[model samples]
Target: MLLGLHDHWQELCHCHVSLSIYLGFLGAQGKFAYKLLNDLFANYSNALRPVEDTDRALNVTLRITLSQIIDMDERNQILTAYLWIRQVWVDAYLGWKKDAYDGIDSIRIPSSYVWRPDIVLYNNADEQFTGSMETNVVIRHDGQVMWDSPAITKSSCKVDVSYFPFDGQECRLTFGSWTYNGNQIDILNGLDTGDLTDFVENVEWEVLGMPAKRNVIIYGCCSEPYPDITYTLLLKRRASFYIFNLLLPCVMISFLAPLGFYLPADSGEKVSLGVTVLLALTVFQLLVAESMPPSENVPLIGKYYIATMTMITASTALTIFIMNVHHCGPGAKPVPKWAKKFILQYMARLFFVYEVGETCKSSKRQPKVRVVDGRTEEGGHQPRVCATGLCLCRHGSLLRDVEYVANCFRDQKAAQKRTGEWKKVAKVMDRIFMWIFFVMVFFMSVLILGKAI
Candidate 1:
């Protein structure tokens, strides 16, 4: 039984050795295949393009995937985008069938070992910016070259801030072959639209959509029509930030004009409030100006701010005029009958303003009569009875005293009349301006916000 067990163990060991040899051969074959691919690429010259027919244009297709919008500089009119650019073209010299090469379907070689189209952005702003050239290129067995690399592209754009903050911008990136014209290279879009599957959201801007188009243009200088692919990226400003930070504050400051009217003329703060609000509006205007690029046409927000400032300034001047009218002294000309009737009677009632002098008149006290030694007298304790049964003071003192009281009454009436006239004028002015300001604000709001919408 021991001899029979030893023979079975030797047979198992021989089977294990045969399996190891088979695995070794597979590994060797993989190494040989890799070596063959390397040898083939070693003799490949990237400088030599495989263009058999110079007249037949090399069909190059472009695909771009927007990874992120690094920044959009409105002041400089530059758009910086992070993109994954893929370019595909056919190279007849690199063709090899899978049947001729042990079923090798595709191989990756250094990008320098193949011919590549010199695709360039016609509107590129940064001359130093270039796509990554160290990435590997994939060559299929059917001679199709697929090259993809990350590019930090900076392109110039024409910015129209006419409706800024709520504006939509269409910026384009045009790609075409630099050296080879339409005869030698024909560029086409690989996708109907740019890929945004991996797009990174921006804080101040949002991507609306991207559309790609191909166009052929015949330049006056060049007879061959140059083919180019254009990718248009539609971006809309994220206005919520600007609205909260800039616009809301401006609107609030504009409303301060009404507060100036609420301030009493006696407090001497009406003009000051109006001036302060005007300055605040000016500061906001500067802030908005700093955010937008300088252009011949004013942006919608800027125009609104300017109109607001003008209104506020006019309101301030009107406040000053109203204060002057309220403080118009007694030395000035007496209030005209027509002016008093219109401002004091009609406008006062219309504005719900009460007359100060009328209240005082209704509550005025009568002159007290006092019993003297001889008789009753008005306005004086000492008295003498005359023949007419009226009290007369000694040495015509009653006459002088009567004249003095009459003079005092006259002066009080004049002062009260002046105060009433000034108050009436102020009230009328305030009411008129309140309506004016309301209309101004309403129209301005509609004009500004309507354009944004």
Candidate 2:
């Protein structure tokens, strides 16, 4: 009985060892089995041929995830994005039962070994691809093919800069199979919506949203509709940089334009100051133009700049007019009565301008004179007319000379008064204009900045 039991135990151990060796052999065979894959390919004449008949549609699904926005050129109307493009489709010929080869579930194969859709971007701007196209293809036991590739694609995008630096843009990447029509290739969206959860933020732009759409187009020449996938990227510009560097300076310069009025007309620098500020504004405008694409509708900043320039030009012209008024000499016409009443009396008082009493008092002061024997004595010693009647008769000339001298003095006094009045009128005008310019600048600033804010 003991011999029999020991023999039974030995047989059990032998059976366990044999089972282990057999399992090891099966595992090794499962790993080294390329023969089955080779057999499958050998049976097919062209691996590149799609499983569907040439006339029947081969449904292909697409999934895209944007990784980054490499660059967007407004001037060139180009958009460059780094994307992971995934193409999923089932190849009926490549399918094999999992039980056929020790439950092999999936395989990684070269993309050249299988059929792939000839997808191309309809609006491609670059002549050559920005990334490598050679990649591995994943195949499941059920013949589901997943071809994922990372690409840096550059495509044409129509740019509208009407509201540049504060504007939002919509750009599209349209993809379609180049050689297959909708009848031959049916493109489907892989996800319910284009996923943007993995999108990397850009420094100059912020992604508002991304939406995907499928379109079918029937060309006039072709009877079949072509399948297309369009991904629209909505982005807004990050305006902080432009606002600080370009807009702030322009606004400051515009404010300074009005300060030119503070320069006294005698300084001869008002025109030069205005023109310098005008040129600086022009340079800022050029900077804006260089940064943005040309468009028929003006940008908000451009409009502001133009308005500022208009104000500056008007101020310069007014400066020139004021200088002319201030420089009027004795030869010029006297200030008009209405102008004196309105500007010198009413407007000057309204603007808080004080009348110059010293000039008026000096002009009104009369020269001291002593009359001797009914004749005026000049310089306290020289006699203007002789006391003798014979002298007067010899020169009724005496009366005529005195009268002529008196008229000369009266004309000189009148000219002095006219010159003073003209100067007062110029001062009044300058005050009025300064107030006008101040109000204009204030209103313009509010309007422009309100729009920007």
Candidate 3:
């Protein structure tokens, strides 16, 4: 039993010894990490370019990942976006021996404690031009440093809203070192295009693609070449919002303009309807103007609204003329021969317009038979009839009075007939103009709005 107890004691002692060794090793490793940080920054100069040779140029690889599109100001011609920016470069002064530093292959430190490239957006439109967030730098044992940060970039973009609401835009974001010439620092595109793997989709705009290009230009101020990387972000506007809010309402108003002609002239609402439609189109045009810049190029929807407004104005003027013709009185002049031939006959047939009945014509009064002074005579005149069926009348004061009354009644009947014909001509012309305006509105809408489809 004593031997077995002795064996258990030995095993317990061995475990205690091993635990002590592990705790000591862990403490030593913690001390080494602390010492490593101190040694790395002790002689490091953050302001210098971290290069051993002054003649060799540093190459910086730049990459951007679009995270979100915050806002696009078309009026101001600016694009605001949230981006993930990555910069990689070699810092010859930041290298360390992994074995001497307790096998630590990489380290993370505050970026302010190291020399960094002063890369900036060339087309910045924001008050705070350098928009990168201060982040840590990751340094590997082989003298490579990587910086990953989030940036809110506001860049100037030339806006073309000719097809607006259904338009596509290509905005560019140019990046390069602000103070460094090509001999001091050269910029390189890390990829052919920007990364979209983590992009958050925006409701108003769709990302088509982002392509990067490198340019080297020699400015007149300096003999050294300035290199830059430009990223072109192609975007298409999502038209669903504008279609429901702006376009569909305008189309409804366009259809309403033609309906003004269908209103009866007697109702006295035809001109009012046309004027209301014109006002509605004007309101829509104002809405379009509010969203777009004051540019020379008008939007497709704006053109459509202008055309519709002009049609409504013309329609309103024609409605007034039609009402004038419809209300012709006995004193008004007769409709011309051409108006009767073209509008009353041909146009009436074309528009399928017809009078309700032949009641519009006055019925002729029959001559009364009377016996006066012991003689049978027609009521119209006292005359002696010859064998040729012609009557010769004798002039007298009573006969003259009767002929004058008959002449007045005959002139009244002819005036009433002419007034009716003029009204008929107005009805036919109204129908013809309605169809003409309908055709114009239809073709104009198709030609302009069809581009969206």
Better of 1 and 2 by lDDT: 1
Q: Write the per-residue lDDT of candidate 2 for residues 339-385, one digit (tens) a residue.
A: 97888777866776665453422333455677665455555677545
lDDT of 1 by residue, 1-453 (tens): 999999999899667754553444356255545654655666667775577786688899999899999999888899999989899999877877676557777767557668999998888998686755567788887889999988898999889998877888889999888888888888888999999999999998899888999999999998988999999999999898888887878887887787688677889888888888888888888887886788886888888888888898888888888888888887767778888898777776676666545452253355887645423467765564466644354447776776678668778878877876777688677877877797788778777767666
For model 3, the local distance difference test gives 0.85
lDDT of 3 by residue, 392-434 (tens): 4333666676677766876987898888898888888888889
List runs of model 1 lying over 4 Å from the truth: 1-29, 356-397
lDDT of every model, 2 decimals? 0.80, 0.79, 0.85
lDDT of 1: 0.80
User: What are the root-mean-square deviations of the candidates from the true structure over C-alphas?
Assistant: 11.5, 12.6, 11.8
> If both were scored by lDDT, which would come out higher, candidate 1 or candidate 3?
3
Clashing residue pairs, backbone N/CA/C < 3 A, model 3: none
* TM, every model: 0.84, 0.80, 0.84
* Top model number, lDDT: 3
Off by over 4 Å in 3: 1-29, 358-408
Q: In model 1, how large is the Cα lDDT of residue 133?
A: 53
Indicate the residue-level lDDT of 324 in model 1: 83
| TM-score-best of 1 and 2 | 1
